[model samples]
Target: MMLPSDFELHRPATVGEAVALRAELGEAAALYAGGTELLLAMKLGVLDYEHLIDLKRIAGLRGVTCAGGELRIGAAVTHRELETHPDVVRELPGLAALERAVANVRVRAAGTLAGNLAFAEPHADPPALLVALGARVVLVGGEGSRELALEDFLVGAYETELGEDELIEAIVVPVGAPGAVYRKFQVLERPAVGVAAVGNLVGGVFDGAPTVVVGAVDERPVRVGAEMLDGAALDDEGAFAALAEAAAEAVEPVDDLSGSEDYKRHLTGVLAKRAVQALGDV
Candidate 1:
């Protein structure tokens, strides 16, 4: 199908060029990553861009590596790539799980991690997982480059801290620190609730406090803090209940055709418990 009448396309070979084009076009231009989300929006008439800056050809933005004991994934790294990456599977199993849990084979092959986070949809799976792992996002823009915690980067549904001319560069996640798990409840392959938990044990006792994050039910991934689990023991029952309550209290879910607000909250609790159980407390 043909795009809307107002759409224009530009392919920039360099990040500098892209930023400059964005600056020149201002609100008239939109960055095109994988075009997975943007194209859909265009088709829906939610977005009308006169210029679409294509970032696909940019160099050095589609690889993964381990550096300084952290996994550095380029912004353009596709979901399929992350799913099959040996380092991701071994070091960040939760992230790999989240990647695999996305829509399906074709979408995974085309969708980019940065694109997913940049779109900042409320139901996206990766943000919650990344926040649970305490990841950081590197952004480049006309002014320069900077890094922001993934937790702070996602402000709300379909919203982010990105400027008009800014682009996500990479994501950095700590490696070899803890065992992690992701639990997702999807209705017919569409996720209704997703929870991610990471655990570290010290001297045969749980240490470093578990990180729990709830996704798909709210505008942004809700992080469950250690204090929320204070009264609960590290065992399965205690951890599960605490984390579930934390997730339930973290956000007010929107009511949609898929489910009701109350239903989403219930699923949040259920997924939270499953995530905790998957992290070995059980």
Candidate 2:
């Protein structure tokens, strides 16, 4: 990888200062936390910002805490933290498993959860489960802060709803969902297909309005409709097929190193069935 254009770096110790610098510099500036994504883009010459506002020096933005019925994950929380933190492992072991399976150890050590979501990489691992978990992201800007559903926050591949002056604050997930399961098919660094299901147990099966999110096969993580299986389930005749087909139909995949659009669409169904089944197993 070669270096991109030169840029000035500003280390800000407060969110206000970081947002202010971003607002002042406009689109020429970007808020930097873990450089895992931004640095790669810079190296590829896809992004070249004139000013980089480093947010690591800011306080109160690097830990995990639970309060008021939600797990508040700081924007700077690394994948390793999600994998090894005692609270994460104990309270949401399924989610911990998902984080553990995220790229390589080095990337896990350096990549922030917020960075991954904000970058909105098509093949990234977190979005599928985050959507299934009913996660919400808080965004801070020069004007004020506001929250958005994780699904809405992720607008498309390499894109988010974030404004030039905005910086992600934290990702918040509901405390207790019935049972959540994440499953994926990957050839190398990035997932080719990923599916996650979070459900509420009603009458010994996931009949409640369970969330099913499919990722990597499209521009963004897609919420698979489960209305076909509302009362029916994996064990029921035609139920699994309907559910899988619905999931596969929901995505419009772009062919790349992962596979062809047809192959990815097929995997979407396979992974969707397996993931929803795993929810029952758990």
Candidate 3:
């Protein structure tokens, strides 16, 4: 498959301008950012659009800021940018590590986090961690702006709740957690399973049930509450293994090229355990 050569590219300099283009063009146009996923889909003939609204030139949409216990990541912020951003490194190093391991260096340098969520690819890593961290997306359109939880925004594999006339403005992530960890198992281009665990530790002991999300094995990230780990010591292998088993059972993994259902389920457990252990080490 090859990209259609006839599609017109429209450059928008502002969020308002981008919204107007989206409203005017409707289904005929598609938002263009990093082009990491969109352009590939076009080339593969999976999507067709008569217009491509280029948003690279849009001002006020390419920086990251930390305030009021959260991090605001602009729509145009790329994976590489997030991986090394000072605020991200200092405040959310787990996320920075996750961003660093996204696909490869080329994709990291060119792919935006907003684009990743908008594409909603299940095998991707960010969604699981971001969802665990309680992230939200800010969307703008002709009707103005609205915010949606990352979990709610992503409907399923290759799908989202984004309106046809709306564009993602930024991703907001809460900044405080005792610590969080993300771990994944990959054999091909994408992971077979990804797990993220966020927990609060009080004086070196688990204070509450941790949030463990299993991704890449299902249509969307599956959030599993690790109640068994509540008040368990970090080195409690029995508790961590129980959490892993629960996470594996929580996801409805499909049989695909990534692996058989059983294979992915096993990977889910393995990664879930690793994620918890990693969080404890932090």
Candidate 4:
């Protein structure tokens, strides 16, 4: 393995210790969750860190539980765990679908939910699902712990609100928000041109006016509000059209090797329609 220059490694047993170490090291240090993203960035020279804090060995940071009518997932929980966990499948099938839809089985086995969110790759799938679920990220740092809505935590491509000393501790997702559905469109077996879409439905109506989020198109996930649907009924045609319009208006996707802006825009409609249709069936 190729190691970056000026590299130092530290394993902290507690979140408090990790935060203190990060503060001492300042920007020269980076947190290592699963090394799925950080390792790649280091190889590409996109990241420069003199110290690496390993959080995997930390106790009480890798479990799933339900409390206060919400699901709490520790940051260290891997995609494979989420995919196979019976509780997750029963509570949030959309999340399980998104987890399975991530890059291959190997990536799922090693990749952490917090790592994926922290990477903030436009092409990643988890962020969109979490946003649609109205999840909250818990952070621990030198300034003490704080909780931020998933939307507020993610700012732009490869950017987040996490302070240098802050590390995500867990994610809290409210239960009974709405029944949700997720859909993704990929090219061959490569990364998706368009990732997943989640829809939360209420008593014959869209919950909280419904929410639609698209990923892998831009820096961060694009969230579409129910108002964008213009009060369309949750019927097949109405739900489909609403999602289509929201996808187009909500995202400002860029052209890349996967496809063009126009192509992605069109997929926003295509996938949105599929997602709405799926919701209607359930």
Name the candidate that leads on TM-score.
Answer: 3
The stretch of ten residues in a row with the least summed lDDT in candidate 4 is 188-197
Q: Candidate 1: misplaced stretches above 4 Å?
A: 202-205, 228-239
lDDT of 2 by residue, 99-217 (tens): 99999899999888999998889888899998888899999997899999999998888989998789999999987767889999999788999999888656556566568999888
Better of 2 and 4 by lDDT: 2
Each prediction's RMSD over C-alphas, in Å, is 2.3, 1.5, 1.1, 2.5
Q: Order the candidates by lDDT, highest first — what do you get?
A: 3, 2, 1, 4
1-282 per-residue lDDT for model 3 (tens digits):
675657999998889999999999999999999999999888988888999999878877889999999999999999999999999999999999999899999999999999999999988999999999999999998888999999999999899999989999999999976688999988898988999988878766788888888888889999887999889988888998888788788989889888999988888888888888777678
Q: TM-score winner between 1 and 4, please give it.
A: 1
lDDT of 4 at 241: 74
Candidate achieving higher TM-score, 1 or 3: 3
Off by over 4 Å in 2: 202-204
In candidate 4, list every pair of residues with a backbone clash. 122-216
lDDT of 2 at 209: 54
Tens digit of per-residue lDDT, candidate 4, span 1-282: 456667889999988888899889998888898888888789878788888999888876789898778888998899999988887888887787778878888888888999988878767778877888889999988878899999899999889999988999998988765556777777844445453444555555555455667777777777766564334556647556766876777788777777788888888878866765566555
Clashes of 2: 0
Candidate 3 at 279: error in angstroms? 1.1
Which residue segments of model 3 deviate by more than 4 Å? none
Q: What would the per-residue lDDT of candidate 1 be over residues 143-254, giving only the tens digit for each residue?
A: 9999999989999889999987898889999988677888887775457888888876544455656778887887888876755443344564666676677778776887
TM-scores, all candidates, are 0.91, 0.95, 0.97, 0.90
User: Residue 158 deviation, candidate 1, in Å?
Assistant: 0.9
Candidate 4 wrong stretches, greater than 4 Å:
1-3, 188-208, 228-239
